[model samples]
Target: MYAYTALGGPEVETFLDLPIPEPGPGQVLIRVRAAGVNPVDWKKRTGYRPAGAPVPEVPAVFGGEAAGVVERVGEGVTDLAPGDEVFGQTVTGGYAEYALLPAALTARRPPVVSFEDAATLPIAAATAHDALVQLDLPPGSTLLIIGAGGGVGVAAAQIARRHDLTVIGTASPAKKDFVESLEVVPVEYGEGVADRVRAAAPQGIDAILDLVGGDELETLAALLADRTKLVSAADRATVARLGGAPVERARTRAVLEQVAAWVADGLLNPRVVEVFTLAEARQALRRVEDGHARGKVVITVPA
Candidate 1:
């Protein structure tokens, strides 16, 4: 087996001849066909996340989202058998050609969707759904999504539109047309962002989903009509201190299952902007670290 491993700052290497890991109790072995690369992968590679949690162990596999066919089922796992096509977030080991995931977290992939598309949905789509559904906003309510051109942002925009909300998305000038094509009002993300948003919705925004954390967040805070309407996934502590709500990512099979169904029905979509082979995982991380990808980046592993 070949797996991409992160060795300290700015270093990722492909290790060949790594032994395939066996599934433990309540886990299943998946032969990964496609893995999704996210901003967090780069952050981890660069040591952005605080140390102390696991994954610092050398030769650590670094992907969180993946879709593939099940190769073997562990003890007590009866619902899924060998050869089941599944998708889920692996706590570790997604970058490998074969990885282990707890049976509870894996869901059967929709028959109509490809592994590459299914690979992109677990983390980004689940986070978007959690943010929108947690708020319980009524149809016709105004929803604002900051950083709308990124992977999570694009998914958030589509979900907001499906719920019948007046969706507003903020992005760079280059992404304006793409965001607007999703039926989201596109505004530039920098100086005067709030002013532009106000111009689009004079009555004020009913809900805000902040994906970017920085000066833009402070700007977003000022535009909210009420503090409760502000929700964020990136910076929880900052959002809480500013009297806004932090949207937590839920690791549940049910959420992934629902998103898969929506994708099958054409109500939801995961925009994949780039694809790379497993050997090119380091370059893929560099692209994500550059912070300009329009959507998710996927890595295909040889079957």
Candidate 2:
């Protein structure tokens, strides 16, 4: 087995002949076909976590989202068996040829979904679903999404639109066209982001989904008509201190199962901007850490 491990600092090393992980009780062993790279993946590698827990063992397999076929099942795992195609988020060990997933967080991949697309669903889509639904947004209400061109942003846009809300999203000039193609009104994110959103939505925004924190937090707060409706998945602590809602998903198998169905029905689509091989894992993490990816970046493992 070959896996990408974060040995600390900015280094990601590829280790050949890494030991294959075994399934524990209530877990399944998956032969990873594709792994999705997220901001959190790189952030964790760089020793970033809000909870401030001790780092996992050095050379920790660094991946959160993965899609693959089940190779074996552990004790008490009855819902899945060998050869079933599935995808989900793992606490660790997804960057390897084989990884273990608790049965509670794993779901069958939809028939119409590909490994690349299925790999992107677990984290971003589930987070978006949690944020929007938590706001209790009314149909036809106006909603604004900050950083709307990225993986989570695109998912939020489509999900909100599906609920009959007038969706407005912000993206860089380079990604404006791509954002607009998702049926969202794309505004350029910059000095006049609020003004641009106000121009498109005269009555003020009913809710805001803020993906980028920092200075944008103040700007997003200023645009909220109902402060309680402002939600952020990335900055839960800040959102709580600022009197806004903090969004989080349960990461359960049932929730991801619904997401898989959306992918199958063509109701949800994850944009894969780039794909790298296992050996190029460093470059994949670099792209995500630089914040240049228009969507998800995936690492494909050769069979």
Candidate 3:
């Protein structure tokens, strides 16, 4: 199995042939068709371990979500069998010819959804869906999404719109047209960004979904009347100090199923702006790490 591995840090990632991983109880072996590249994927390579998740061994495979054909199922996993088209959150990694996906977290891929689009759902779309659910604002309410040009932000904007929320998203000036195409009011991020948002939404932001952290998040925090409506998936400590909460992700097959349903129904589009072959996995990571990708970037594995 060929996959990209984290060679100690963000500065290094290499492709290698590793032994195919076997599925244990409650797991499934997937012949990966596509894998999604996300900010966390690079962050993990740089040593950012999610809370409560163990640090991976060195030269760890570098991906978080994938979509593919099931090659086999493990013990106690009776709901799925070989040849099922599925997409899900990965317990190990997705950047490979084959990988293990926990059966509980897996969702069936609808015939309407392609492998590339399904691949984007497990992490990026799932996180966006979870973030919107956490915000819990009613229809017609205003919600602001920071760093809205990236995968999660783009998905969040579309989901918010579908749920009838007025979306105001922040991104670099380069993404103005792209963001607007999703029906989100695009605000340029940087100095005085809060003022820009304020001017755009004179009624003030109802809820804020912060994807960019540091001083920018602090500035956006001021736009909200109720700090509890503020959520940050990027900076936990800063959001905590501001009396906001980080995204409480629901890593369940249910969430993936719902999200996939939306995608299947044309209610949500992942806007996968770029696709790369596994041989170009490093370049895919580079696009996300550089923060220049307009939407999701995916790596397609050879069959």
Each candidate's number of clashing pairs is 0, 0, 0
RMSD of 3: 1.4
- Candidate models: Cα lDDT each: 0.83, 0.82, 0.90
Off by over 4 Å in 1: 1-8, 12-17, 50-55
Rank list by lDDT: 3, 1, 2
Select the stronger candidate by lDDT from 1 and 3. Answer: 3
Model 2: what TM-score? 0.93
How many clashing pairs in candidate 1? 0
Q: Pick the candidate with the highest TM-score.
A: 3
**Which lDDT tens digits does candidate 1 get at residues 163-257?**
88999888999888888878889999888988999998898889889888778888788887688888887777677877898886677899999
Residue-level lDDT tens digits of model 3 in 1-303 = 333355355456676777888899999999999999999888877777766778777777888999999999999999999999999988768988998999999999999999999999998899999999999999989999999999999889999998999999999999999999989999999999988999999988899999998999998898888998999999888999999999999999999999999999999999999999988887888899898999999999988
How high is each candidate's TM-score?
0.93, 0.93, 0.97
Q: For each candidate, C-alpha RMSD in Å?
A: 2.1, 2.0, 1.4
Q: Which pairs in model 3 have colliding backbones?
A: none
**Model 2 Cα shift for residue 81 (angstroms):** 1.1
Ranking by TM-score: 3, 2, 1
